[model samples]
Target: MDMTTQHITLGAINMEAENPVELAAFWGTVTSAVPSVGGGTVYLPPAGPGGFAMFFRPMAGPRLERQAAHLDLTVPWGSRQAEVDRLLSLGATYKWDVLDEVPHVQWTTLADPEGNLFCVAEHPPAS
Candidate 1:
């Protein structure tokens, strides 16, 4: 008997911004993944060889306030410092510094030019 079940998958995240291209590019730079343009929107594929992808949705006008939702990127363990330096070099402006409790380590809060928050830290090494 053929009982193979089909499955659906999540493609990406859609962000609302005045300038999709610019915003997308910022995320692309932050994540080091090229952004793809389609349907008048910018899309970021999964990070590294293969990962989760994100998309940008164009808002009709400027944002009235900060986005209620945000992104947090967890880098591989023991690589937070290095990742921080690399992202800074890539044009990710520093928004804040992370100080954790309980066997703590350093983390940096950064933002794209469009003001989207994303974090970089080394939690688990690349395989």
Candidate 2:
């Protein structure tokens, strides 16, 4: 048995949305991921090269509970503030800004419409 061989390929995102369509739309616009499947759960198709697929699952939870896990997005230098503002305009709420005072800088924290945290970072150049 090999460690690499035991790993299964699966990717998804859990969401608590009153309306899945609207929630999917919001994510779609932000990530440019289309809905690959619909009905019980909505799947957002993959984006450009190097991008991965996303799925939305209904969760029975409130919008204010703190999340132990979240998505971190990193924007290019000097782009965090602007991108944060843009996300705010597009149905996102500003939770708090985080920075590593010791290491200079790191990332900003933001949450989506469903209160799910995701970061808007500088798009890394394709290697």
Candidate 3:
């Protein structure tokens, strides 16, 4: 099966938010994306040609349930703590410690301002 034969290409990953502008700005900073708005929704340009990007749309509802999918962010090798500190200062909340709960993993679970969960870890150094 030739996967390229499938015409479907991922355009973006979108998240439902109460405030699309705010969430989009947060995600833009997180991913270093160039953010733009269209039809009241936010779009972030991909890092490169044909790369998958991000979007955020407004949603009105009660409290959101835990999502099965979450983001795993990486920092430069050995900078996990510093990155976590920076994100925390930028309005991210500490959720849980992976090493404390899982015993070996060196990741920390965190939540964005809107309570969307994500993880931050150190990227392995280049060989």
lDDT measured at residue 13 in model 2 versus the true structure, 0 to 100:
61
- Give the Cα error of residue 124 in candidate 2, in Å: 12
Candidate 1 is scored at a TM of 0.71
**Candidate 2: tens digits of C-alpha lDDT, residues 12-126:** 5656676777788888887777875467678787677656567776666665556777776666777888878888888988877656533445566777886778765554344
On TM-score, the leading prediction is 3
Model 1, 9-104: lDDT tens digits are 767877888888888887787767899899888889987654678888888776757667666677767777787788777777888876664244
Model 3: which residue pairs collide? none
Winner on TM-score (1 vs 2): 2
Off by over 4 Å in 1: 1-10, 47-50, 102-106, 124-127
- lDDT string for model 3 (1-127, tens) is 7667667787788788888889888877776677898887998878676456888888857655768898877666678888888889888999886655443347888999899999997645545
User: In candidate 1, residue 30 scores what lDDT?
Assistant: 70
| Candidate 3: worst-modelled 10 consecutive residues by lDDT | 97-106
